[model samples]
Target: MFCLLLSVMRRIICSLATQLVALIVVIINWYQWDKEVEGYIEHKAVLCEFMSSALHEAPASYDDIKGKYVFGRTTRPQFFSMLHRYNVIQAYTQKKEFVWIGISARPWFIGFAVLQFGYVSVFCIQLYNTVTRESWKAKTTVPLFGWLFGGKWVSNVHGSVGPTAEGHSVDFSAPFTGQSAKIRFVGGGLEFDVSGTVKKVEGLPSRKPTLAARYELSGSAQLPKEFLGLVFPLGPRRAAVVHKFSAVPLSRPLSVGIGEGVWHGMGHISMDYTRGLLRRDTRWCWCTATAPEGYGFHLSAGTYDIGGKSMENSFYANGKVALLNTAVGFRKVFEKMVKAEEENIDISSGDTLRWAVTGDGIDLQFACVDSHNGTVHCGVVDGNLNHSWGIFNGTITVNGIVYEFSDVPGALEQHNMRW
Candidate 1:
C-alpha cells in the first residue's frame, strides 16, 4: 500500500509540471505577438501621413500668416502626428512651446520572464544540477537585451530653422532675402525665438581685382531638458549629442584676379545679364563680400538635394544669385598618406571641370565663365573640405585659371565648421 501511494504522488507531480510549462510558452508567444502588432500599426499610419504631407502641401509652420504664401508638401501638425504614433515617443504642440519625452524599460522584469525558459525543457539536466552541486547557468540574456532596447526620449523648445526655400542661382550673398522663414528638421527638441539680418556689398568697377567686406549674423535656439542624442545619425546606429551652445562669427572678402576680355575683376561682364548663360558654358568665376563690421561671409546656408549620382554646386556673387550650376561626379583619383598628420586621405579626382560633393559638403570646379564686368564681391570659402571651424582648403579654376583658398571666413562664426 505504501509503494502504491508513492507512484500516485509521482504521477500527480509530473502532470502539474507539464501544465506549468505549457502555460509559460503560451504567455511568451502572446506577449511577443502583442508588441509586434502594436509597433506595426503605429508605424504604418505614421509613414503614410508623413510621406503624403511632404509631397502635397506647404510645410506646416508654428504660426500663421495672413497673406504670405508658402509651398511644400508637409505641415507641422502632420509631422507631429507621425511622431505621436510611436509607442516610445510622445508629441506636444503649442504656440511658442517646445517639449520632449523620455522612455525606458525595467531590466529585472524582462529577465525573469523571457530569458531563462530555454533550459527548462531539459528536465534531466535540471534534476541532475539540482541534486548534484553543479552550477546551472541562469539565463542572463534577457536583461542584456532589455537594456539594449531601452533608451531615454527628450524634447525641447529652442530657436530653430529649416529649409524655407529651394531654388537655383549664382549669387548666394543674400539668399534669405524676401524668402519666408521656415523650420526644417527639429532634432534635439529645442526651440528658439530667433531673428537675423542679411547684408550685401556689390562689386564696383573702380575696385581692384578683389572685393572684401564683413558682416554680423546672430540667432538663438531654445533648448529642452536632456533633448540630446536625437539628431539624424551620421552613420548606422551611431549618434552625436549636442553638449553645449555654439556661436560663430564670420568675416570674408572677395579677391579676384583679372583675366583677358571685358571681364571686370574676377567675374564675367556682359552688356545684358541672361540667366541662360550657365546652360551653354561649363565654367564661371565671381567674388563677394560679407556684411556687418567683423563678421565674415557664411556659405553654410542653402539646401542641396541633388538626385542620386549627381551633385548640385552653386556660387553666390551676391545673395539670391546663382553663378554656375555644375554637375558633380565622384571618382577615385589618387590616395596617399599625409606625412605630417599620419592620416591616409585621397585626392580623389583628376584636375578637371568635374565637381564632386560628399554628404552635406559641396565642391565646385568652375567649368565656364560668361559674366562680363561681373566683378561681384562675394564670400569665398572651401565648402567641401572645411570643418565646422572653417579650417580647410579648396581649389577653384576660372576660365583656365586656377586659385586656392584656405581658412576662409563666413558670415556666422558658428557656421565656420559646417559646409
Candidate 2:
C-alpha cells in the first residue's frame, strides 16, 4: 500500500513537471518569433536548403516570404498562428487549424484527426470544431477455419461541436519541436494519451534547433469508455501554410489499450500540422504506409500543391526522408465543383479499395482489408471523409537503396469540405 501511494505521487510530480516544461517552451517560442523568421528567410533563399544537412526551424510569420519552398526535413511549427494580412495572395474566407496523428501497430491500427475552423467576417466571428478517432483490431485464426468464422472489429468515434462563440479549447503545443509528441484528449467517454518520438539517424547532418528545444518524451493511452458514434459535417485559403512529417517510426514501441484488449508493440507514426487562411471549398486524396523494417511513404493529389516549390509527398528509408518532385494523381475520388486529375495513382471502384501508386522511383499497390467512413452536413459546414487500412506491396528506390516491401500496413484517405 505504501509503495503504491508513493508510485502515484511520483506520477503526479512527473505530470506537473512535463506541463511546466511545455509551458516554458511555449513562452520562449512566443518571445523569439523574430529569430525564427530570420532563419526561414535565410534558408528559403538558398538553393541547397532542400539537401542541406543543417537543421531548420519554421518561420514565425509568412509575411516576408516571397514564394513557397520545401524544407530538407520536417521542421518546427513555430510560426503557424496567422499569415500576414497585407501580403495576402489567396482570399482566405476562414482560418483553419488542423492536427492529425496515425499509428500502425501489427494486427491493430489507430488514427485521430482534430480540426478547428474560425470564420471571421466584418460582422461576426464563428467557430467550428470536430474530432474524429478510429481503431481497428485484425482477426487472427487458423487459416481456412478462421476464414469461415471471422470476427474483425473496428470502432469509430466522432464529435462535432457547434458554432459557438467560445475560444479554442484544445491545448496543442505551438512550436511542436520535440523528439516525442504527446497526444491527450478526453471528452464524452473517449480518451487518449499517446506519445510519438523520432530519433535522428546516425551520419545525418546535424540540425540547428531553436532555443530550448527538448527532443525526448514517453506516453501511453487507454480507451475504457464506450465509443460514441455521433456524426456531423464540416475549409478556406491564404498561402495555405502547411508542414507534414510522414513515415516517422517511433524509436520506442507504442502500447495501446482498448477496453478488454491490450496491444503493446512497435508501430510507425505520422504527423500533419497546418494553419492558414483558406478557400471556402477544398478537396484532397492521400495515402500513407509503414513497413516493419522502418520503411514508410506518403502520396496525395488535389492538395499540398498550393503554388509552392515544396510538396508533402515523400518516402522514408534508411532513417532518412527524401522529397518527391513529381505530380500525383487520384482516381474514383469525388470532387464537388473542382476537377481532379490522376497522374500517379489510380483507385479502383468497388466494395473493397485498391490503389496503384507509381512515381519516378516508387511502384506500389494497396489493397483494403477494412474501412471506416463518415459524412457531415450541418447547414453551413459539410464534408465527406473516407479512411481505409490495408496492405502495401511494392518497392521504393531512394539513393540507390531499394526498399522492397510487401504485406506492410498502410492507409488511404479522401476528403472534400465546404465551410
Candidate 3:
C-alpha cells in the first residue's frame, strides 16, 4: 500500500512539472511574438510620421517643381503598412499564442482570447480588402475598424496652428492637396460668381504652367436631403482629379475656384492669418471627407504640415478627425472604446461643429456665415455619413460666401487609388 501511494504521488508531481513546462514554453513564445508585433507597430508609426512630414514639406502643387520629387518621394513606407494589414491575420495568430499563456490561469481567459482573436481577424481581413483594392462593397464595412480600434492603433501626433490665413486675401490655385480641395456649390443669398482661368507664368521649375477654370453661382435655402445624402458620403476620402490643361496663376487678392466640379460636403475648414515682420504669409486650407458608416476601414498613414504645425492627423468614420498637432492643443475622444456615436469639434475660430454619426450614416451641422461677412451658417440635415468612401454634403460660408454642395470625393482615394 505504501509503494502504491508513493508511485501515485510521483505521477502527480510529473504531471505538474509537465504542465509547468508547457506553460513556460507558451509564455516564451507569446513574449517573442508580442515583441515582434510591437516592433512592427512601432515601425509603422515611424513610417507614418515620416510620410506625414515629407508631404508637409512637399509643395501642394508639383507644378513648377520637377515631377522627380513627386515620383522620387518614396511611398514604400506607406506601402509597408498596407502589407502589414494583409499579414495581420498571421500576425494575430502568432500573437494570440501568447494570450493563451494567460488563459491557462483563469476561466475567462479562453473567452477573452477568442473574442480578441475574432475581432482582430475581422479587422485584418477588412484592412486587407481595403489595401488590396477590393470592391467598394466593403468600403463602409472596413472603416468600422477605425471606429473600433482606431485610437489604439493610430496616434494623433498633430494639431492645427491658429488661423494661417483668415481675412487676409490671397490667390488659391486649383486644389491640388486632397485636404485643401475646394468645391463651390452656390446657393443662398450670396454673390460674386467669380471663376476664371489662369496660367503659371513665373516661379515654376520643371513642369509647365497649367490652365484651369472655375464657375459657380451662390444662393442659399434649406439644403435638400437628397443632395445632402450624396454630399455627405464623399467627405472622408475627399479628393479631385485635376486635368491640367493650362498654366493657372494664383496672385494675391484672388479667390480662384480651385476645382472644376464644385461638390460640397460636410467637414471642417481652417484658415490661418498671421502677421510677420518681413512679409505676411496666409494659409487657407480645409479638410473634408465622407464617412458613410461613421468610420473608415483603411488606415491613413502619412505626414502633413500646413505651416506652423507638422504632425499626423487621422480621420475616422466616427465623425472624428484625430489631429496630432504638436503646436496646437488637441485630444483623442475615444480610447479603447469600440465605437463612437457622436463627435463634437470646437475649432480655434470659435466655431462649434457637431456630428451625429453611426455605422449607417451621419448628420453634420456647423456655424458658418449668414451671408459672407462672417455670420452664422447653421442648419440640420441627414445623409450618408460613411463619406470616407467618397460622399458628403454641406453649406459652407468662407468670409460670407455661401455654397450648397454635394458629392465631394475623399482624401483616402488619392492615397490608395486613382479615381
Please report the candidate that would top TM-score against the real structure. 2
**Candidate 3 lDDT (Cα, whole model)?**
0.22
User: How do all models score by TM-score?
Assistant: 0.24, 0.52, 0.24
- For 256-283, candidate 1 gives per-residue lDDT tens digits of 1111211111111100011100010012
Against the reference, the lDDT scores of all candidates come to 0.20, 0.44, 0.22
Ranking by lDDT: 2, 3, 1
Error of 2 at 260 (Å): 2.2
Pitting candidate 2 against candidate 3, the one with the higher TM-score is: 2
Candidate 3 lDDT over 154-198, as tens digits, reads 111221111111121111122221111112212310111223332
Off by over 4 Å in 3: 32-90, 93-391, 394-419
